[model samples]
Structures are given as structure tokens and as C-alpha cells.
Target: KSAVSRVLSGKPTTTPKKKPGSPSKLDERTKRRIVRYMQANIGVTAPSVVASLQLGVSPQTLRRFLNAEGASYASLKTSPPLSDAHKASRVRFAKYHLDNHTDFSTTEWFQGQGVTTTEWPSLSPDLNPIENIWAYLVKQVYGPDKPNITCKAQLRSRLWHAWETMPKAVIGNCVGSMTRRLTQ
Candidate 1:
């Protein structure tokens, strides 16, 4: 009798709802699309590029959406820039060329060699041909969903297989595409 009485007693539960005036929550597909676009455009730091994509999203709206998802403009600015280790490696590698005195050790040596180093402008992965390679691999592995992958390990393994089997001719094609901007 006591067990039956306990089973009949339960507390009500409620799910929290969005507050009024908040931006509508972004869907997962939309979020993934935005991330893919961002990855490809990692080279072009211009807000206008995002606006022009016109995936029903304004540049400011996209910016807010990215911020909400934890990406920032600084990510593009610092990408692929030489780290201290890379810089040191460059300096060390120059030692082998000392016979030419065109090394990067001293400012004079660099200037004498007609070598110039400057800060890189923010990059857009869209401008990079390698970004296309990554897209191609992703599409080959996950295009239109033949079946739902059960786990992250299985997905990763498939992606690795796709990457390994990517063709050299395809890489050449992507590299050739770099000569012209399709967006322009």
C-alpha cells in the first residue's frame, strides 16, 4: 500500500522558454552553414563579404550570431601568422645560407638581400585553394546523409579515409581555380 502511494506522487516539471524580445534561436543547420562560410572566408576580413553572401543574413546579424557562437574577428586576424617558434626556425634555417649573406639574422642582412617582411592582412579561407580541398573531403564523406553516423569515431574514420583517397588531379584543379575569383 505504501509503495503504491509513493508511486502516485510526482512533482511537475517545466522547460524554460525564451524571453520576449530575444533574437530567435538559430537552427543547427543555419549555424553549420555560417561556420562553413566563415571557414572558407578566413582570408577576407571584410564585413561586406558576409553581407553579400545574403543567406538571408545581414553582416551585423551574422556578426552577432558568430559572437553568440563564440567566434570573434580576432580569429581571422591572427590566423597562420608566424608564431615565435616559426620565426626562430626561419632565423635558424637562414644560417645555412650565410655564404650568400642573404640571411634574416640582422636587419642589414635582410635589407641587403632585398627581402622584405611585413604583417599579413587578415585572411579569408575562401581565398585559399586548400579550403576547397577540405570542403570537397567533407562533402565526399557526409553528402546528403546516406545514413546517420552513430558516433564521432565512425565519422572521423570516414573523414580520414576520404582525405587519404583524395586525388592529386582534384588538388591541381582547386589550385588552378585560385587564379580566378568565382565570387567576382
Candidate 2:
């Protein structure tokens, strides 16, 4: 065997070769199109979006992409439709947090790897399926064609009612999805 490079010493190490794999089905242009469509039709379901876009990709694939983009698709009742200014403000807030929260050392030290932060935020929300349960509870609190929430007391009462009355099956399904989510 030949001598190995003294990586422990001051000698520089060679860069690792790229991993071989099939390219992604969705290119940048196609992905941008899908995002724009989903934004415009925010209320549409993932399977419906897959059908509408006819992108030859499964709903799961599209959902994975959206998750990576920091978009929430949880079935929650909207407070009100956001205006352009509200949307812009939200974007700015997200960007500011991203800029401030990212660990500079990870970027400086690592190359050709995925985004790294101080915390493993990528394994959040989805991994913990209680997020879906929370969305369901919010929807249950408001109900269909319900009056707008007026005060903190009223909201609290409705929230309590929803939680107490939530179907056991709904809660069970959300919890059960954890294994499936982990596989993905």
C-alpha cells in the first residue's frame, strides 16, 4: 500500500468527488412554474395540483419540494387572505431570520454539502406530526362558515371546545403518519 496523505499535518487535502445519481425530474424553470401555480391557488390540494400541473411527478414529490421551499401546506383555516404588502413583509421576515440564524462557520468550512444551521431545523414540523393535529384543531375551532373570532376569551373557549371534541381517529392518524414520514 502507498503512503496516505498526512491530513493531521499542515498538508492540504483533496476535495471529494461528486456522488453519482440520476438528475432531478423537475428543472429550475419547471419548479418555479409549480411554485407560482401553488401560490396563486393556495387552497388547492397537493394531488389536485399534481393533476393540474401535469408535471409527471407524484404529489409526494411536489410536497417535498414545497417543504424545502419553506412553504406550509397544512390544512389550516386562514385568518384572512394576505395582501401583497403582507406577503412581502412575510418574505422579508423569513429572509431576515435566515440571514441572522445561519451558522457562518458551516458555510465557510463545508463545501458542496447541504445547508447547515446551528439546529437541525429540517427535521422539524413534518417529523413531528403534531403540527398536522394543530392545524386540524384550528380548523375545528373555527368550523365551516363560522363568524370571525372577536376576543381572546371567545377564542379560548372555542379552542378548548375543539380540543375536547376532536375525533380520536383524527389524532390517531396524525400520530400514525410518523412512521411513514420517517421512511420518506
Candidate 3:
């Protein structure tokens, strides 16, 4: 009698009923098309892409989709002019690297340090693979799908994400290429 009563009792099933149809506003085909468009035009902003493609999706939706696919947007900004102190620090760093690592043909000794005095260029982004890494970092941080960074905090967060996610092989390749670049 108890089993019969329990069976007769009106109760919802333990398993939730599945909802029919997709939750996404755009279909898979449309999304794929948008991705293709983005791949071709890397520097194009998301808003411009939406406008051009006529995807009929909101900017926020597009951004979310693109971000999910590892795309972000960032504007090019000019670096601030280097201060005298910053310049001096750069010089010191360069001097340290040159002194510790570089092999000079001349047997000149400076301040008993066995280091030759060499003029380090003020800026040498071409010779440094770190610059390439920085460029890669910037691209990764500001993906084609991501929104433009509006504040320092956002920039820092994105930068951290890029740094953490960057592959060791990429860094090694950049460093490896340095010798070839130096020779050229």
C-alpha cells in the first residue's frame, strides 16, 4: 500500500527536463563565417567586423564569441618619452650585459674589471629577441576578439594572462633567432 501511494504521488522527475533548441543567438555556420572574416582581417576591430559582415549580432555578443575563440582588440599607443633616469638605467643594464657576456677583441681593462668600454646604442629593438616577445605578448593580450583596454588594471590583467600562457618554445625560438639576427 505504501509503495502504491508513493507511485501515485505527483512529483517531478529527479532529472531536469532538457530544453530544446540552441541557447546561442547565432548559428554555428554564422559563427564560423565570422571567425573566417576575423582571421583574414586581424587588425580590424570587432565593431567594424560586425558592421561589415552584417552578422546581425550585438557588439557585446560578438565580443563574447570572439573572446571565447581567443580574439581581442587593442589600440596602438605611443610609448611615453624616456626620462633621464630611465635612460641612465637602460645604459647601465646594457653596459652590464655587454661587460658580462660580450667578447671584445681588444685587451683593454677598465677599473680592474677586465671590461672594455663600448658605446651601447640608445635603442636596439632589432637585435633583442625580447622585443619580439613583447610584440607577441601585446598581440596575445589584445586579441582580435577582446575589447580595447580602457584602463591600466585591464592592461595589467591581460598582460599577466599573456605572459602566463606564452609557450616556452616560442621564447626559446625568439632567443635562438637572436644569433641569426645579430649575424645579419
Candidate 4:
């Protein structure tokens, strides 16, 4: 085999270096804003966000920006723990849907991925981290919406900017709560 071929046959590889002069793209400020926006709405609409920023950047640019930060938009809007109220709401909704729809079943829905009705805690609302997170996010993400959100475009823009600027720590903290929940 050629020397290059022999080396490839079995060897540990070193981490590759980032190519120099790659697009000196979006900065941390913009990345957080996107995350904040997503948090504000508990969801995000891509085109609306793009227009709001008016940064003349493409979704690809925003995506690349996230990728560079080792995070993605999906990571920001993960499902938080189900508090009693939230769980009860979910169960009620599921039950109503089940009764209304012959094809649906509560057991199946409850047992689906990341869901477990058996784990529902009583008299311990704190056990549900998602509840706490919603409270926190509502304050930071949606606090501005109360005074006034002029228009859809403006709202969209503001959310995008907020999401782009949201701190990784905040996202990390909320997501991390899931870990503690699962472990217990």
C-alpha cells in the first residue's frame, strides 16, 4: 500500500484546524439575539426573524453563526420538565384529544419519548424544572412585549435580536435542568 494509504489504515487523528479567512461572519451578539427571540416566543419563525434583523444576512449566515458557536436553534427551544400544572394541562389535553379522536390513546401518548405519566410528582411543583424555566424565560424574553410590541415585523425583529443575544449560560442552565430531572 502507498504510505498515505498505510497511514489511513489505522491511526489516531488530530483535530483539524479551522480554515483561515473563512467568512468572518456573525458575531456572538447576533447569535444570542436569535436564541433570545426563540425563547421570547417559545418558538421562532425563520423568515420573520431574518427580515427583522435587516442585517441583510441569509438564514445560511445565521445558521453558520450558530454552528460556529457549537450550538443550534433547536438546542434553544428544547422541552423543559413538566411541572404539575403543565403536566396536568398536558394530560388533560391528551385525554380530551383521546376522547374526541378514536385513533388516539392516552397511554401511548404518555409513554412516548421524553414523557412518562408515572413520573408525575404530586405536591412537589419544584420537581418540574420546566415550570421554573418558563418563569425565568418569560421575564427575560417576553418582558418587553408587555409594554408594547408595535407590529408583527417589529416584534419579529425584536425577538430575533433578543434570541441572537441570549446568553449561552441561560440556555445551558435550562437544558441542564433536564439532566438533574432524569437522574433523579
Candidate 5:
């Protein structure tokens, strides 16, 4: 009775106890393949990945394994439509660019000019070079060492500053990549 008490009252062992369950159906090699598949296909949900990969694992099991391997899933929210005035401003801006640049008169450029004032599907950011530009501007405006922007006024000021100070070449390069993007 004294020995039992001592054993029960003693500090718990530091070593981890084995979980009570069957071993994982996925081996390390299969897990690595799943990880690689997930990496290759970003923005995919856990269930979708499991179905597409034909991994023969349950969604819950795949999710658990992915979580253990530091994988995360997120669903992107769609942006709301632009107001009429915003649409008008976009049209004006595109017209100004198109009218000024006589050299940019290709069929592709014309198609781009036509779409400038239109509302695009929310999931099509990859089709828009402006998205890349915005990402760059965000990085410049709110870099790791920079102080947080606390208000709308501060954010607007920072955005303007970042835009004005940005190299014309950078903007030009982004615009120039549109053809390559379209081709791809």
C-alpha cells in the first residue's frame, strides 16, 4: 500500500504517452506526397484535396494530418462591386492612358481598355496585374519595421506616398507582364 501510494503521488513522467488508436493509414512517403500536392495547389480546401488527390483518406483524417504538418486552409471572401462613380473614374483613367500611349494600340491593348471599367469576377485577381501592384504597394507602405497605420487618413497618406515614390519602371514592368500573363 505504501509503494502504490508513492507511485501514484510521485511526479508524472515527462515522456509522452502513446495515443490510443490505430496507426495512421498514411505512411511518411504518402504524407510527403500529400504535402507536395497541397503546396502545388494553393487555395484548395481539405475535402477538395482529398478528393482530387484520391488519397483514400477521410477528410477529417487528412485535415488532422495536415494540421500536424503545419498546413492551414483559408477561404477567400469575394469583394463587393464598385459604385457607379468608382466605375466612371476607372473608365476615365483607362481612357487617359489609352489616349496618351499611341504605341499601345495592339488588339490585346484594345481588349484591356474595353475591360477597364467593367466589374470582374472576384476570384480572377491572377488575371489582373493591378493586384500585384497593390501587393507591392502594401509591402512598401506597411513593411515589417514600419509603424502601424492607425487611421484612414494615415493609410491614405501612406498609400499616396508609396505610390508617388514607387519607380515608374516597376509599374511599367507590371503592365508589360500582362501579355505574358494572358499568353499563359
Candidate 6:
């Protein structure tokens, strides 16, 4: 019968939804463990995740999952200057977090040597070519796409891979253009 006839007959118009193809790879317990570990260690890395948790997945897979969970690090876009009230709140926060919890003997030593800290304009030192290495690694570590990474040693190996794999012309061009850029 036509759909108009079915409507006139008062039959249901829609079909039932299909079941999912399969269950998720990670069960509830595993999901909770991952979330707890990340919370406990604010700076958890991908290599560490695979090594410590033995999740049997690749680092790339974990990274994609974490990104889906909205746990990926964000790139900075803009920030306003702090007002005096904000500065005072920051001072209070430093006092609570630092004096109470931090071992700042190094800070004290600097103070004793009269190496006083001063406010400076913001700087993004990522312009240096070497900084590219760190940016690449950060994407691998914090970006969390893989799952089988065994240890920090894997991270070190990847570092060497990056260093070895970069094209020569990129570095050569940077160096070669420096003089011309400075002359301008």
C-alpha cells in the first residue's frame, strides 16, 4: 500500500532502529581507569599510557579517543592582560599552592643571590627550528592516537626518527635566509 494509504489506515510510518555492529573495545572499568589516571597525572603521556595501562591498543588509537573525549591540548589564540584584581588573586593562589606544597629551595637560592624575578612581556620561543622537534613530540605524546607504545624509550626512538627524517633543505633554507632577513 502507498504511504498515504498506510497513514489513512493508522499504521506506524517509521521502521525500528538497527542495533550497533559491535560493543566498544574499552569496557567501563577500563574507561574509568584511563580517566582516573589522566586526572591523577595531569601531564600523562601516550607512551606512558600504553606502558603503564597495557591497554593493548596503539598510541594513535588512544589519541583519537582522547581527542573525541575533548582531552586534547588547545592551541593558544588570544589572552587579555591581567587586571590588578586578577594579579592579587594569582598572588594568593601562588601562596597557597607554592608555599604549602612546592619545594622551592631553588627559588629561595635565586632570591638569596638577589636574582629577583621581574614581569616580562609574553614570549613564544617556538620560532626556533629546534622548537619544531618539541612541537612534533607534543603532538605524539599529548595528542594520543596510538595505543601499543611500550615505554618512554619508544618516545626517544620516535625523537630520533623525527631528527633523522627531516629534510635537509628545510634547515638549510632557514639558515641561508637568516642573513638576508636580518639585512632587511
List residue ranges in candidate 1 displaced over 4 A.
Answer: 1-125, 182-184
Q: Write the per-residue lDDT of candidate 1 for residues 1-184, one digit (tens) a residue.
A: 4665655675334458878896655568877877887788775543655555556656667677878888766543555789999999998977655445233367667778898865334443466688889889878888897477899998998899888988999999988877676455
TM-score of 5: 0.33
Q: Model 6, 123: alpha-carbon shift in Å?
A: 26
Runs of candidate 3 exceeding 4 Å displacement: 1-112, 120-125
lDDT of 4 by residue, 1-184 (tens): 5778757887645567888885655666776787777557654556677787765778777666657656545545466877899989999988667543244466577667557545444454465556765576456556855567677986777667666776778767877878777776
By the TM-score metric, which is better: model 2 or model 3?
3
What is the per-residue lDDT of model 3 for residues 1-184, given as tens digits with 9 covering 90 to 100? 4666756786533668788966888799999999889788767787898899898888888989988988767775658889999999999988666655455434344636766565666555467788889999978988798899999999999999999999999999998888788786
Residue lDDT tens for model 6, 6-38? 999987898898887766677778878888888
Which run of 10 residues does model 6 get worst, by summed lDDT? 118-127
Off by over 4 Å in 5: 1-19, 77-184
For all the candidates, what are their Cα RMSDs to the real structure? Answer: 27.4, 30.3, 26.0, 31.0, 21.9, 21.5
Cα lDDT tens digits for candidate 2, 79-144 = 888999999999998875685656657666664466554455553545767888899987887878
lDDT of 6 at 127: 39
What candidate 6 gets wrong by more than 4 Å, as runs, is 1-22, 74-184
- State each model's CA lDDT, in order: 0.72, 0.81, 0.81, 0.66, 0.83, 0.71
What lDDT tens digits, residue by residue, belong to model 5 across residues 1-184?
5666767988554668898999989999989888899889877887898888788989899989989988777776688789999999999988767544345456468678785534344445476678889999999999998999899999999999999999998889999998988787
**In model 6, how large is the Cα lDDT of residue 89?**
100
Give the TM-score comparing model 2 with the true structure, all chains together. Answer: 0.34
The numbered model that scores best in lDDT is: 5
For model 5, where is the 10-residue window of minimal lDDT?
116-125
- Clashing pairs counted in every model: 12, 0, 7, 18, 0, 14
- Residue 105 local lDDT, model 3: 36
